[model samples]
Target chain A: MTKITFKDAAGAARTVEAQDGSTVMETAIRNAVPGIEAECGGACACATCHVYVDDAWTEIVGKPSQMEEDMLDFAFEVRPSSRLSCQIKVAPNLDGLVVTTPAKQG
Target chain B: MTESIETDVAIIGAGPAGLFAVFELGLLDIKCHLIDILGKPGGQCSELYPEKPIYDIPGFPEVSAQGLVENLIKQIQPFNPVFHMGEMVERVESLGDAEHPKFRVTTDAGTEVTARCVLIAAGGGSFMPKKPPIPGIDAYEGRSVFYAVRKVEQFRGRRVTIVGGGDSALDWVLNLHPVAERITLIHRRDAFRAAPHSVNAMRELVAAGAMDFILGQVSGLKGEGGQLSALTLRKESGESVDIACDDMLPFFGLTMKLGPIADWGLNLHENLIPADTEKFETSTPGIFAIGDIITYPGKLKLILSGFHEGALAAQKIHRYVYPDKRLVFQYTTSSTSLQKKLGVG
Candidate 1:
C-alpha cells in the first residue's frame, strides 16, 4: 500500500492509503477529497482531476504526458508542478506523495 | 496494457445519432461498437429529461426523450451493436494512411477500440453532474451521498434527505418515499424548477404528511467514514435544521461542455467539430462527426438532422472501407437485401 497526502485547495490535508496500482486521483475520489472533481472519472480527458505535485515530490511523481499536458491546458491556475492526478499512479515507495488541487478544476 | 476490441466502425456517442448510425452502417454490412460516458445509452435525452416531450422528430408527432431513445434502440436491435457504457473515449489517434485510415480509441477505463473509421456523435459532449458546494460533502460521497440513482434498493428503510429544486430531486423523493423510512427534501426556496406535475405531486405528499419538505440550503454534513448520520440545513430565515438522515441525495442537474473531445486534435469551431454536410466527415478524413457535436452551414442540432447525417455518413463510409467495391444506394423500404439484414423477410 502507498500512503499519499492530498492537500485540497483550502489547504486541508487528506491522507489515504491506496493499493500500489491505484492512481492518486483514484485515491482522492475514493477518500472523497474535495477539489478533485474527476468529472470524466480519470479518463485524462476532463482535467477536473488537476493537481499540483508538491515541489519535494515532483521528481518522484514525474511529469505529465503530452496528452495529459494537452488536457491540463484547460485547467485553471496550472503550475510547473501541475499534473493530472489520474496520470500519477501510486507506488509503494512514494509513501509521502503529496499533491495540491487547484482552486477550481476546469 | 488494456484489452482491445476491433470493429469496422467505432461510434463515439451512444446518443440518437450514434445509435442511428449503427443501423445505417449495419445496413451496409459495416459493424460498429459504441462508447458512452453514461451508464446507459440514451445520452441527454434519458439523462437530463427522460420524460420531457420532443416534437421535432420525424414521423412521431411528439415523443419523450426516453421514448425516442427506446424506439431507436429497437430500430437498431437487429444490428447488435456493442456498447461500452459508463466509459468515456479519452484518446483517439489515427493509424494507417489517409486512403485507408484506421483509429485507435481508448476510454478512461482503459478500454481500447480499433476501428476502420470513427464517428463523433457525442451530442454536446459528456454530461457532468453539478455537485453542490457543501463543505466536506465529498467525505460522504459513494457511501451516504449520491448524484445519480444507480440503485433504488440501497435506500430501503433508510432515512434519505434529497436536496434540489429540480425534477430529479423531486422525482426521487416520490420514488423513494415508500421504501425510505423517512424522506426530507430541502431546497433553497419553496419554489421548484421541476415540472409542474412533479412539483404538484411532491406538494401533495408533503401536504398529506407523508414526507417533510424544507426551504433551506445544505450548510454541511455531519458524518465519518463517508457515512452520514445527519445534515445541517440552513433555512432562508437563518434557522438551522439538523435533519437526521442516513443518506443525502443532491440532484443539482448537469452542465455540458466539450470535455475531452478538445484533446483529440480535431479542428474545433466554437467547441463543435466542423464537418461537411455531404459526408459529415470532419477535418480529419475518415473521422466522421454527426449529431450535435458537428457544426456546418445551415446545420441544425436536431435528431432529424443527425439521422440524415448518419445515413449520408454510412454511404461515404462504405466507399472508404471498401474502395474497390462499387457503392449502390438503396432504400430500406424497397430493398430485399436490407430487409433480410433486418430479419424482416
Candidate 2:
C-alpha cells in the first residue's frame, strides 16, 4: 500500500494508505482528515481541498489542466507550490508522497 | 492520527447541492454529518426568500422556492440525512488503515469531527449586498434601510423608490403600484436588464403614470435621526438631485463570487471550476467538482447539469475511494426498447 502524508496549515500531520487506484484526496476524505474541505467534492471548482504537493514529487506530478488553472484563480492563498488535492491521482510509483491541506474553505 | 473521530460523510452548506448529496449517499447506506451556516435546513429556501415564488425549477408546476426545498427534503426522506445547523467548517484531515479509513473535520466553533468523505453543497450564496452608497444614507437603516422585504403587501399608500434594473425591481413596481402614492424608478443604466415582458410591463406602468423613471443613480441617502425623508441622486453629467420618498428598493443586480476558496489557485476558466466533464474531476486530484460549479467542453451550468454532476461525481468517487465496492452504472433502458415503444422499431 502506498503511503501519503497529509499536513495541515497548523503543521499537524496525518498519514493514510493510498490504495492501489485511489487518489490522495480520496484516501484523505475516506479517512476524515481535518483542514481539507474539498468543497467541489473533488472537482477543482472549489479549492477547499488545497495542499502543497511534497516538493520531491513535483516533477512527477504533472501540471494542472487549463480548467484547473482557471479554477485555482478563485482559491485562497495561492502559492507556487499550491496544488488542489483533487488533482493528484495516486499510482504505485508515488509511494511516500507528502501533502498539506489548507485551513480555510469557502 | 493517534486520536480521531469518525463519520461516513461530512457535508457543508445544506443547500440543494449538499442535501441532494446526502440523499445520494443514503442510497449506499452511508451516514453523514450535514452542516450549514443557517439556522434551518433548507438553506436559501428557508432563509433568503421563504415566501418568494419560484419558476423554472423542474418537477413541480410552480412553487415557492421554500416550498420546493421542503418538497425535495420530503421526497428524499428515504435517505434519513442527519442535520447540523448554525455551524461552519474550518478544517479537514484524514486518518486510518489503507483499506478502511476515517476523516476528521474541525469547525469554527472549535469542534473536531471526522468523516470518510466531504461534500460541499453551498448553493449560490456568497455574500449579500448592503445598502448602496448614497449621500447621508448612513443614519436611516432602521427607519428606512431594509436589506430585503419578504411581503410587499403593506407598502401600499406610501411613496417609494425602487432603485434597480432587474426583474425583482420591475416586479416590485407592479406589486406596489396599487398601494403607493408615488413610485419612482432610479437606475444606473438606461436599459433594463430584466425579462422583456417585465420591462414592458414596467414601461406600461410608467406610461400610465403609475411609476416614473428618475434617469440617474442614487448617490447618497440623507435623513434626520431616525426618519428617511430624501434621497441623493447622481446624474450621468455629474449633477446631484434629492428625491423625497418613504421607502427605497435598490433593484441593482447583486454581484456574486467565490469567497476564501479563491485564495487557493486552481486551474480555472471563468469563475467555474475547470473539470473533466466525463469524470467530474478537477485539475486537483482526489478532489472532484460537481454541479453548477464545474464547466468544461459542451457543459452547461444549470440545475439539471448540477444533478448530473452530483450523480456522476459520486460514481467516480465511489470507485476512486472504494475499490472494493466495484460499482458500475448499469442501466435497463435501451434504444431498441425506446424505439419499439414509439413504434419506430
Candidate 3:
C-alpha cells in the first residue's frame, strides 16, 4: 500500500493509505476526500478531480499527458503544477506523494 | 410521508434496456414500474448524445440516438409501464430470505417500492456536471447562476455571462444571444474546443458587436441571497474588470457517477456490478442487473446486448414470480393472449 496526502481547499491536510496501482482520484473518492469530485469516475473526461502536485513531489508524479493538458484548460485556475488526480497512478515509489486540491474545480 | 408502491418488478432506470424489460415482463403477464434519475428516458443516448447518429442498431442503417429512444418508447407503449421520473434509487434492501426473496427499493425522493424482483439498468449510473471553481459560487446558484438551461425563457431580457470553451457554453452563447438583453462570454483563451462552425459563428458575433468575448477568468462575484448583480473578471494582464450581469451560465460538461448504487451490498467488480451470464442476476438473489452497469467475462456494453440480457432476465424472473407455473414459449404474433396484452389482438 502507498500513503498519500491530500491538502484540501481549506488547507487541511488529510493522509490516506491506498493500494498500489490505484489512482489518486479513486483513493480520494473512496476515502470521501472533500476536494476531488471525480465526476467522470476516472475516465479522464471531466477535470473535476483537478489537483496541484506539491512542489516537493512534482518530480515523482511526472507530467500530464497532451489529452490531460487539453482537459486542464477547462479546469479552474490552471497552474503549471496542476494535474487531474485521475491520471496520477499510485505506486510504491509514490508512497510520500502529496497533492493540494484546487480551491475550485473547473 | 414516504409513498409506498408495490409492483411485480421494480425496474431502476428508464433507459432502453429498462423500457425493453417492461415489454418482456409484460408478455409474461407481469407488471413493472420504472424509476429514473433523469426526467426522461433514453439514458446516455438521450442525455449525452441525443442528436448523434448510431449506425450499429439492428434494423436501420443509421438512426439518431433520440430517434431510437422514441422508437423504444413507442414499442413499449402497449405494455403501459409506470414511470417515476426525477428520482434516484438510494438503497436496495432484501426483505425476505434467499429462497423467497423480495426487494424493498427506496429512492432519494422518500418513495418506497416493494417488488418481487429488482432490475437495475442504470446506464453508467448518474450524469453529474463538473462544477466550476469560483469561490462562494454556490451562493448564487438557482438565483442568478445556472448550470443547465431547463427552459430558454428564463434568460429572456437578462444580462447573461457564459463561462467555458466547450460545446455547451458556445451553443448557449449562440442560442441565448438573441433573447438575452446583453451577453458576455469569458474564457481563459480565445481558442475553443467546440466545432469549427460554432467558433466561426461566435467570432462573427463578436465582430458584429452582438456579443462581448473576453479573454479572462471569473475571479469574483458580487451578489446576495443567490442573486448576482455583477461578475469580477481577471485578465491575463492582472487587471480586474467588473461586468454587470444578472445571470451566469457555466457548462463544464458532465461526468457519470455510480451514485447510490455503490452503497448497495451487491458484489462489485472494478466499479461495475457482477452479474451471472445466465440470468444477469447480481450477487444478491432476486436482484438483476443489465445494461452498462453490469459486468460479465465477455459482456459487451451495447443497446442490443442489453436488450438480449433483459429478455433472459425476464425468463428467470418468471420462475421467481410464479414458482408453481412452468414457463411456456409463446410467439407474440400468434398467441392471442400475448397479442391482447400488446393491444394488437
True contacts kept of each: 0.00, 0.00, 0.33
Worst ten-residue run, lDDT, model 3 chain A? Answer: A38-47
Best-fitting candidate, scored by lDDT: 3
Better of 2 and 3 by TM-score: 3
Clashing pairs in 1: none
Runs off by more than 4 Å, candidate 2: A1-106, B1-5, B52-58, B92-105, B128-257, B264-266, B328-345
DockQ of each: 0.02, 0.02, 0.19
lDDT tens digits, residue span B146-242, model 1: 9888789999999999987667888898899989998999875566657899999999999999899987777779988899999987777778878
Give lDDT: candidate 2, residue A16: 86
**Candidate closer to the true structure by DockQ (higher is better), 1 or 3:** 3
Best by DockQ: 3
lDDT of 3 at A65: 88
- Per-model chain B TM-scores are 0.72, 0.53, 0.73
lDDT of 2 by residue, B2-80 (tens): 2334566676667666667665555544666676656678765565456666666677567886787787687556656
Candidate order (lDDT):
3, 1, 2
